[model samples]
Target: MKLLETIMQRAQQDPQHIVLPEGNEERTLQAADAILAKKAAKITLIGKPSEIQALANQFQLKHIDQATILDPENYDKMEAYAQLLVELRKNKGMTLEQAQKLVKDPLYIGALMIKSGDADGEVAGARNTTGNVLRPALQIVKTKPGVSVVSGAVLLFTESPYGENGFVMMADLAVTPNPTAQELAEIAVMTGHTARTLGGFEPRIALLSFSTKGSAKHELVDKVVEATRIAKEMAPDMQIDGELQADAALVPSVGASKAPGSDVAGHANVLIMPDIQAGNIGYKLVQRLGNAQAIGPVLQGMGAPINDLSRGCSADDIIQMIAITVNQAISLKHNKDGILH
Candidate 1:
């Protein structure tokens, strides 16, 4: 089965509660209607119920009524959620009044819902900026235990014959402009995890660079080599190698020629680019020139699964992201329970 089909099936088997802060947006409501029809997840919309319903009617979205709409204006548990926020932010001198006022924002309330376990995951940014969407999540939900930074990965369905049946994952594509060696190591490990859980394949990760092995010496190449070592220490069982050029990472012949006897030099299914510039340029080049279907910038290392969408996303994009978030939530639960390593 296709990767997305498998993810959708898994979501159907064990649906999660996913909250959408942009409930009043037309495309989000449309996607919510579709998700309700598919039973992919239980959706909580953070907006006025009546207004959402009216917009649904305007769009002729039949299944929007099935979504649970919690109005930010008059949520029943406002005080409770506000208190939760105050507790979370009290160290930062956040007062109850400040928390109460902030909770009235749909984005803040949606994140608080996830933080309180009222929802399992969150999807937003249809009408909001990336910074605005992530602010509440970072403030409330925070990063996962032992994780310092949040990174984004894209699951590229390529037409190439390499990379686990033409499926590959690349990371640091949407966030983190110039990560240090430690942060790069974390990104590599987290991207590998995303590959296993969402891509349904064992990850052979390559920390990409301009140099393959010690063929060239530079501070940048040194950084990748250090990251590779740190990543191996982090996830010792994972297949990771690096300071490899793009060709050595993806091409079997080049990998063999460049880095002989290395486990991950040639057969890498997860490519961890050194920085956002390389990642952004690389993914786009493949997506446009190679005609690959790029699925994410799936946000990783959050305390809960909270994904940000491009403001220009379509309803179908939202639907796919919702399913992805559900699967991430499931994976996180399994990891916490030691069901998956």
Candidate 2:
């Protein structure tokens, strides 16, 4: 709630323009109404205006028209956007006709808006797969400078004492599978930054493994150990340690005993999972069993702010994602000067 308030204040102090590609989806429309009501940011819905309006009236979603609605078929900038897309993809063997066809996709159009600064960010995936939501961004928005890999982090919150300060970040749950040492290091950096940005803490990062400080020796543990070294080398000022067992990462005494002289042992607020299986299963376990609130698969390391929603996400989820996206926009507009980077 405090985070939401902070987002609201930031959004009000400096509004961001957000584009939603799944404008025809009921949940998106519902969220648009609430986000507009909160003035969380200016939202533009990508949909056929007439059909969107008719559905809004039928569903009784208020303030539908408060957000701009654009249909790619009839948008005034379609051709210009097509030309731009062609220019962007010309080296990739794209043609004017191919660009024209791709521009018809709402996701591409929304991505174009971001590339052109027409919008500060884009959020979609309620009605589309993560791949569909991300492809256009990969093609147009690309990755931020110095970011080699992109990962997704879920910020989980709970009242359980196991959670550090009632907050924690679990990484690579929605993206990246079987990461190498370098990729794992990147995920750690991204998750650490995400924890600080959204959770309001100095990150104590734990690169998790089944072993604790070489208590066990295997290729898996070796990978974590190597990742820890790389992460420390890359982020010396960050309090990070790795090759930690899950309990050692969370329990202070266990961490002290298992990983003596380590800064992140037993004090980690961010967990960098080695692979998607662990990352996905770990977050779900905390969310479902520990009764923690799982807030994201917040896609990280993008050139501009963009996010993907679970198809089952609620309107409230969308609103929260919009808030997070706005914070990301703030980070970008102010010289990438946020805890996230």
Candidate 3:
């Protein structure tokens, strides 16, 4: 509850509109009710108003009757958005007819809504696959400059922690597999920025691997070493180090002995795994074995403040996701030039 309140307080400070495309999902609807009640964000649901309202009533979610709901199929700006999509993706062979057809998807429409400034941020995936949400956002919202690869980062609040704060962030967990060194560097930079902006921690990023620097020799260790170099080059002012094992990265005594001179050795707030496999598995292991709270797998490097949710997430999970999205939106709002390197 303390963790939830910390996020909620920050989110409500400069409230912004958040669009939810999974309006028909009961958890999403219930979360919307909680969001509205908390006054932490303005709610917009992407679905037919009648149908969403019916479900909202069925769930007995407060403020549901008054929540703004949009039907992608019948939105008044559908033609204009289709034209924009065509123009935006003309290099990809998007015809107006095809754009018009794609706009029928709530995901696409929600992306367009953010693209068109109808909303500040977007969240979905309660019932959709990650690609279902990511594809449209990638096509419509795109990536911020210099962030060529988008990744997933989950913020873990632990019973006992290794991050500078009491929380840890693991990256590339739910998106982008087998990233190149440059791509991994960009992901690390984004995760560090996310830790500061959303996780309330001054970021110390550890580029994680199976071995501490020069402790073992493998292509995998080489990959982490190269990535660490690029991450340093990318964000010179940021504290980043590693080619570190999980133990060396998170355990203070081990970090001190293994990588004695590194600033991020034992106090990393953000952990950038070597690849998606390591990231996905590492986060889940900590989440289950360490009694940690995993809040995201949040989509980072999108042009806007859109996020994805686990399909199995509860209503409380949705609320927290919205809070995270709000923080991302605020960070973007305050720094349009770029939130981080």
Point to the candidate with the largest TM-score: 1
lDDT per residue (tens digit) for residues 50-121 in model 3: 889889778777787667888877878899999999999999999988998998888998899899999989
Model number with the top lDDT: 1
Point out where model 1 deviates above 4 Å. 336-341
Error of 3 at 171 (Å): 0.9
The order by descending lDDT is 1, 3, 2
For model 3, what is the error of residue 338's alpha carbon versus the real structure, in angstroms, after optimal superposition? 5.5
C-alpha lDDT score of every prediction, in listed order? 0.89, 0.85, 0.86
Candidate 1 whole-model C-alpha lDDT, 0 to 1:
0.89
Task: Write the residue-wise lDDT of candidate 1 on 1-341 in tens digits.
Answer: 38899999989988999999999999999999999999999999988888898999898898887888898989789999989988999999999999889989999998998888899999998999889988999999988777888899998998898888888999999878999999899999998888888877789999999999899999999999999999988898789999899899989999999999988877889999999999999999999999999887799888899999989899988999999999989988887311212
Model 3 gets an lDDT of 0.86
- Quality of model 2 by C-alpha lDDT: 0.85
The C-alpha TM-scores of every prediction are 0.97, 0.96, 0.96
Q: Is candidate 1 or candidate 2 better by TM-score?
A: 1
Prediction-by-prediction clash tally: 0, 0, 0
